[model samples]
Target chain A: MSTPTHEMWTARLRGAWQRNLPIEKLLPDDQPAYVVSWIYVFGVATIAALGVIIASGVVLAFQGPAWYHTSDIGNFTNSMHFWSVQMFFAFMVIHLWGKFWMAAWRGNRVRTWITGAVAFVVSIATAFTGYLVQTNFDSQWISFEAKDGFNSMGVGAWFTVTNLGQMLLLHVAFLPLILGVLTLVHVLMVRRRGVVPPIDAVPGNMEVHK
Target chain B: MTGWLASFLDHPATYLKWGWFQISISNLIVILIMLALFAAAILIKFPKGRE
Candidate 1:
């Protein structure tokens, strides 16, 4: 007897998924002892700050620019969004510095490192779009100042910073979506590959004194 | 509060300029604080426990 088409496809997908990343590795309960450093905390801290940024941004979006400029509550939420972004960048850069020094791609974890680096680049673009959509004098000044740079690179044809509508849509939708997906992939790769062990902790290496 | 503290808090931002570089005092302070925090994170001892 032949298996049903749907069952066969489902079985193939399940086998591939399980072979690549089992459930335990995906949602690990423990980590290597080397991960017990304060430096490791910065990655989770960055994610936490991103959560605050998204929550505050959602509140700001509901109220709109005029409300945020006038209402005290709206102003408070805007501040939250702004400060959370500051925290996010601060933590992410610190985490990146720690990872670089640690040679975080030491094992077969090169994809994890690359995804993180790509996410950092994407975040800068996301933040730039955010600045363009602020609907304030600062935004106007920045857009005017940045226009020539974009034009010089030939990106201004499609990405006109002075166009508030386009900038706002990119900031509020496209860039955030891309950043979120990049972050998710980076984290999953970290989980699947496992955290890179310390350089000196490798067994049977006789290059230096203990 | 003290006079200097009040002045620093209430007055417009102070800026430092040298050649082509200029930065507001508030921004400089925040940058310094971030540096300090990074150093502290590296130096501080983290507690270890079994998972």
Candidate 2:
């Protein structure tokens, strides 16, 4: 007499899920009272900005750079993508710095910090590839200027930004795919860790006596 | 005033060079904005013992 394989696997998954993210922690409507500070809001704002950025970028991806640079509707979507990236970077930088100052890695939350840092670094690469694929004077100049430095480091052959086709594929596909994965990991870690409390916050102190 | 600040922040021609580092006005603006945001977040406090 043996347990069914399906049941065994299901039981293991259930155990892991329970150990990692119990339902109450995952969907708590009530937050700890110290969570009242406005700084906590920046993380949500950053996530929102990234959502818009990816949405606009996807729309832009359906059209080539020439179309976006020339046609009205394409131009509108391009502007949306441009501004969304700007907002994304702005919000992300603020959130990253805020978390750093808060020492957000406290109480075994180190994975959260590392994931966020990974997301930030990947975002820089994605943004640089984005600029290179812009099909404008700025892109040409940047590619030309950057090539020499890359050549000095002996990476120019692999990452030649001057090659529009290669750059477009990287900007539209590879880098964004990596960014999406990094963001997913970052979000899952945040969910698992819950939010970090302030430096002096007592573990079981539910409320502050005002 | 708005135009002046915009120009000050985005004067791409205004470049500064150091040992192996080069930056323009727009880059400076970004750095300043990030620092200001960081400082502002740090200055905001939660209630005592609330962490």
The sequence of per-residue lDDT tens digits that candidate 1 reaches over residues A94-123 is 899888988999778888999899999989
Model 2 lDDT per residue over A13-109, tens place: 9989899988876766667676777677778888888888888888777777778989989888888888888878888888877788779998788
For DockQ, the strongest prediction is 1
List the candidate 2 regions with Cα displacement exceeding 4 Å. A1-3, A6-10, A208-210, B1-12, B16-23, B42-51
Interface root-mean-square deviation for each candidate? 6.1, 5.2
Q: What is the lDDT of residue B22 in candidate 2?
A: 89
Per-residue alpha-carbon lDDT of candidate 1 for residues B1-51, written as tens digits (9 for 90 to 100): 368887768777889999999999889988898778888888999875653
What's every prediction's RMSD, in angstroms? Answer: 4.6, 4.2
Which candidate gets the maximum lDDT versus the true structure?
Answer: 1
TM-score of each: 0.86, 0.82
lDDT of 2 at A69: 88
Q: What lDDT is reached at residue A180 by model 1? A: 95
Report how far off residue A94 is in candidate 1 (Å).
0.3
